[model samples]
Target: MSVLDCGCGPGTITQGIAQIVAPGKVIGCDLEPGMVERAAALAEGANLDNLSFQVGNILDLPFEDNTFDAVLSCAVTEHLGEPVKAMSELGRVVKRGGVVGITRTDWAAHMIAPSCGAVNRFFELFESGFNLQGGTMNGGRNLPSMLGEAGLNVVDVLIALSGAYTPEPGNAMVNGWAEWIENLPLFDRVIEEGLTTRDELDAMCAEMREWGAQPGTIAATGGCRVVARKD
Candidate 1:
């Protein structure tokens, strides 16, 4: 069956979907032209004839009504102000009885053990800045309701906790997260909004590294996947 991967970043998951639905068409769409180019290049490199990529928006998808047999999106709704409207658009592109799956992060359920002051301060600033930018921090937990509101029949909801523990010697988990989070656009947003200074942000990341170095450090976050049918 045909499939659409909305907001497919880099097409890593989209490539896998194309493989799963070989001989059937799969279109990966994203808002960024650069991301579309990269996804298309990846598909070309893999020599997958059934896969294609395009630039599109979640709130205003470019496809015609009932264009796809199924749709899958991940980590995109949380950044959207009108998540229900976006889901409605996803539904609009699916054939009757087609499925739509979405995965999102519930930031309220995120937990970092050995919760140091720096980490806490960082989250405070980051969350505030994120909300100020019109993004939802707890979008995952609301997906089921959002889907239902979008005129889809909720089929399943899977909520899970994913995390990594910091191992000794290299301080893998903590160091990696510290570096990764520092590089995220959210970090820059926090600074740009004057919520925190660059020095403080750097210090926070450093402290996170140190905190992870301590014994029994674990960083976990909650995520949810909701599946619905366009009946």
Candidate 2:
């Protein structure tokens, strides 16, 4: 069946979806033209003839109504200022009886064993900055109801926990996350707003690194996955 991968950043998951629906059309849409270009290039490099990429915003998708057989979006709604509007747009594009799947990370459910105060401070500041930037840090849990509100029937809900167990120093799981934390725009916005200083941020990152270095250090986060159907 045809599918649309909304906010298909970098085409990582979109490529997988294309493979799943081989010979069926799959369109990956993202807001950034660069991302679209990157996705398209990756798809071409992988010889995924069934996949295509386009520039589009979730709030206002470029497709006509009932265009695709199904729609799938991952890790997108949490970043939107108008998440329900975006969901409605997804519903608008899918044909009748089509499925819409969304997966979102729930920051409120994020857990760290032997938690460090510095890490806590970091998340607090980060989440505050995220909200200030018109994003929700822990909106994953509400997506099922949001889908229903957007005129879709909720079919299933799955809560999955992703974790790093005793990760080595500079491993991808913990280190990659730390790196992403270091580069997030939220921290920059937080600094610009005078909410915190860069020095403190550096200290926090250092402490978090030390915490991750400790033996048996574990970090876990939850992802809420929802499946809805268009009536």
Candidate 3:
């Protein structure tokens, strides 16, 4: 069956879906022109003739009503100010009896072993900044309700808790959290708001790295996957 992957960055998921559906087509859509170009190039390199990429807004999809047999999005709704509206659009594009799958992370549910008060404070500041930027840090918890509100029947919900205690420098879970923390502009906002000082932030970062490298330390995050269908 035909599929639509919303915000299909670099066409990774789109190509996978295309392979799964074989003769069926998969369209990868993203709002950024650069991402669309990158996705197109990747699909081309993979020789996925059944896959294509397009630049389009999630709030206003480019297709007509009931255009796709299945629609999927991952890690997208949290960035939206109107996630339910986007869900409505996703639902609107799927034909009757089609499936819609969405997965999102709940940042509030993150767990870190050997937790320090300073690190927790840092995360609090980060959450504040995320809210200030119009993001829903707890969006994953609202998926089922959003899908139901969008007139889709919620069929299944999967909760995946990811954790790692490896000392390896590039461990996906550890490195992912570290990279996200390092790249966050929230620290700047926190400093500007007088919530914390640069020295304190630096200290926290050092502590985080040290804690991550220590034996028996663990870092974990929560993800929610929802599958819904249009009846």
lDDT of 1 by residue, 73-113 (tens): 99998888788999999999999999999998886787777
The 10-residue segment with the lowest total lDDT in model 3? 169-178
Judged by lDDT relative to the true structure, which candidate is superior, 1 or 2? 2
lDDT of each: 0.85, 0.86, 0.82
Error of 2 at 114 (Å): 1.9
Measured by lDDT, the strongest candidate is 2
| Clashing residue pairs, backbone N/CA/C < 3 A, model 2 | none
Best TM-score among the predictions, by candidate number: 2
Tens-digit lDDT track of model 3 for 1-231 = 989999998888888999999789899999999999998887776767788889989999999999999999988888888889999999999999999999988877877777756557666777677677787666788889989998899999998777787655433454455556667776677678787787876677776666666666667777889999999
Better of 1 and 2 by TM-score: 2
Per-residue lDDT of 207 in model 2 = 77
TM-score of each: 0.91, 0.95, 0.89
